[model samples]
Target: MSIFKKVSESERNTKATIFVGNIDPKVNEIMLYELFIQFGKIKSLNLPKDRISKTHQGFGFIEFKTEADLKYVVQIMKGIRLYGKLLRVKQAENKSNDTKSVSNKPRTVDIGAKLFIKNLNPLIDEKYLEDTFSTFGEIISTSVDREANGESKGQGFVVFNDFTSSDNAIKNINGKILMNSKVVVTYAYKDDKQKTKHGDKVERLLATNAKKHKMLDSSTQPTKKQKR
Candidate 1:
């Protein structure tokens, strides 16, 4: 009976998730699982392969059955050098944009790259968000955040290739409210923005990091707190 209690407690506290970063383009699911398995029991390994390109998406998710393993990897490995690159392993983004594709049911305006949206609905599934946006434009992409249960974290990115379509989308539905959630629209920048805010010294550091941080691009805008 004591052993059973111990096992149940272990199961509850041992579960956690990590967003594996700085993956070598050549790395595959099996290698990743083997590498992280050292941390603890792996609940799942999700590496998105581009359906069109059938290549690695450069990032993947690793889930552990317990919080101990998850917390251990997130802290000790968050900035540890892996494969000559500094891996940004941390708790996955709680909120992300998810894409929904809608082939039918056109809207009054087209949504293009001009407008950007953030602050998403956690309960709304990714497909639901994509379908809503598809009514506006030819979507570029929708990024939805997920947890172990594969539930939305309630924030995501929506991009359109055309500016006018974005403007038309804003005019028609900026504040109409969908999915029982209000949306905020703004312009989005690359992750490089963070480096510029502190100073040249910091920017140089960030640039150097970008060399190994395959997750971030050279032009990514930094977070607001990092702004100059």
Candidate 2:
């Protein structure tokens, strides 16, 4: 018999999920699979993609067979650069904010020059998005949503430096054929005040927690009197 014990498919997915971010656009499913499999058996690997266009969303999730394996990957993979971008690996966010679950989606309140797009072609990537949209004006950024398996989610966002260009893009490109698919483009809604408030709260919370941790660590250290 082989030295390694065989694990069932269900058993492989019982542990923590790792959220990987700042992914290089060029990275693909095969590369990620090969790299992560070295640490442990993966239950599921998802790279969120645009729903319509089906392009990599520059982030993904990897579910391991055990918590130990998941933690090991996060610890060792920190600051590891691949394809010219440093990866950010951490525990996956709980499903509380999942679009389907959130009754009042916060994204609907967003106000900016950014455009929300849907029904993108699977073959299209970020560069293609920029190139195609740049004709209207300078693009601030472009992103395509992808799923865990690195497949396109058929939706994405593009931000322009100014509203004029954004308006032009919406007028000129909305409902246009892109790579054999008709795309829907509209203003991306955002709530800047709420977002900023939330950001400040998070920062304060992290700082407070860090201070508490430091105090606890220092208090637990052995002193000269104890050593004597």
Candidate 3:
């Protein structure tokens, strides 16, 4: 009969994803860290960047070392005032299944070089992006921006396992996509440290937002009184 009984116990309770919006444009994840780390041990923190200006949109994700940490933070963060926005915190998304594609995760075999990809469509995702580039070389990793809720920023990074492969990808992909106006691919350094924080930020920001969503049960449809 507990109010939260319907909230099933999560298996991986330690990690969480949080959403952040209504943020102060000037505030970044580093500033958020200073505020949220008070709850527990923080393993990782991310502040997804705005595709246009590379600035944060006042939201990001934080991962603590244990579930107790996650719960503690949620309890402490709800309705808490910081950056002029009442923070919404909750469990992070489980993207582990989506990451199973070997083409996506960090390639242990270093490519000894990085390549920049250009002309990507704003609608594509990290996996699809990798496939387009994989034909040219062994890709070590990839990232598409989580801009505007769920759109790519027409930019990304693809790290090859070898310089020859990287060179080959550039030679083949550069002008080919341009044929139909898809995008022209270019060999460039894979986006390095920048991605780490932002990816985490995007994931958390989304998860946090989801938690605050309002749901209506059809069987118990609200009456005028309930509506009020």
TM-score of each: 0.37, 0.40, 0.38
Sort every candidate by TM-score, greatest first: 2, 3, 1
Off by over 4 Å in 3: 1-65, 68-112, 145-153, 178-180, 189-228
Report the Cα RMSD per candidate.
Answer: 16.3, 18.4, 18.5
RMSD of 3: 18.5
Which candidate, 2 or 3, has the higher TM-score?
Answer: 2
Best by TM-score: 2
Model 3 C-alpha lDDT per residue in residues 1-228, reported as the tens digit of each score: 121121222533335534343344456666777777777766566655533335553345566677787777777776554433334455665444322343322112322335555566665655575677667655545655445445545666665544555556666776565324456555452244442322233433443343334221121121221100
lDDT string for model 2 (183-209, tens) is 998865454343332213343354345
Find the number of clashing residue pairs for candidate 2: 34
Once model 2 is optimally superposed onto the true structure by TM-score, how far is the C-alpha of residue 107 displaced, in angstroms? 9.4
Global lDDT scores for all candidate models: 0.49, 0.59, 0.48
